[model samples]
Target: MLLSGELGPGDRLPTERELSTRFWMSRNCVREAVRTLSSMGVLESRVGAGTYVTDLQPQVLLDGSSFVLELLRHRNVWEVMETRRVLDALAASKAAGRITAEQLSELRELMATMDSALDLDERIAADLAFHRLIADAGGNQVLAAVLRTVAGGTTAARKRRGLTDAHAMERMHAEHLLIYRALERGDADLAATAAAAHVAGVEAWLLDTDDSPADQ
Candidate 1:
């Protein structure tokens, strides 16, 4: 029914028994099917209310990958950044080619948060949102999924590093400007280059801050 458009996003699904009756299947089968769809982020169940269809956006569904990210601790930070660099660059390149005006407007709002917000936490939130917006707009769910996982993996490190350095924050705003400008111009190559540079700068910072005894 979902595939046949008998149900649409935000539509509340019938009770398991109702579905079983409608489809001539057992209630257990209906329950299992609902559970599976819920895991896939296609169906959402509310305890008191019942189940409904989800928006099914990739970003909304891919958060489950964060558990896998936790298991990637054995991977080097540079290795992770290397992957993000490539994925983000490609995502940005794609977004530049096809982003809509409404999406641009949203990006500009995030940029404003990064620019004028005095709270470091707010600024960082905007920073992450800006990056995610580009990837989501890229229209490639798989790339967005991988990038979100890689990014979710580093979120703790970013907050721990703090955003206290005034100069660094300024540079961050500038780097975001470069990327957003490229995106506004619909320059895929330039967007890719800027995205790569943004991630590369992050890698450089991580290397410089290496506080292990070997470096000490």
Candidate 2:
């Protein structure tokens, strides 16, 4: 209600007693609900001023997504990657149609930076940024939020697997370039194909490495 503009930020909520009576619910239930929303950054309680709607920024709402992804890291690596691939493929398809020329140029610049990023940490950061840019180009906040969570999870999983390598980085650069080119040309099919192929390449490499003796 608050986020949808039914209630505005800084607008004080009704008193607990009034809420309980009006809603015909126990005060305890309302209190718990408010507490949960507060924890999620959807509501704020001011000491005497009363509770009000929060700013409801994307970052605030999606903050718990990272933590959830982290907890699910080891349990289903392949599943996580599969989910990411699907999301990214959809994002790429949409971006091909929706992205602006300026956004395409920005992606080109990020790709260029990734080419020279020799350090593992730098490569990871650049890689995440590239994917995030694609999500942003899709022009959907919910999709972008989901992509951020998956990207963070992928980073965490890569650290645990010790999977960063020069070859992997090179492959990523090439794959990203292909996807960017497709989007630049405004070819939705090609963009989606490139995105899927890129993710599949990573999936194959990770699986091959996992089966290798050293991974055991």
Pick the TM-score winner: 2
Query: Which tens-of-lDDT digit does each residue in 1-216 have in candidate 1?
Result: 988999988999999889999999999899999998898789999989999999877676787777766556335666666788899999999999889899899999998887888877887788788888899899888788779888766665565455533367766778889999999999999999999998887767766674531221
**What lDDT would candidate 2 get against the real structure?**
0.80
lDDT of 2 by residue, 120-188 (tens): 677678778888988999888888888888878778545434354447666777899899999999999
- Lowest-sum lDDT 10-residue window in model 1: 207-216
Residue 137 of model 1, lDDT score: 95
Candidate 2, 195: how far from true, in Å? Answer: 0.9
For model 2, which pairs clash?
none
Error of 2 at 114 (Å): 1.3
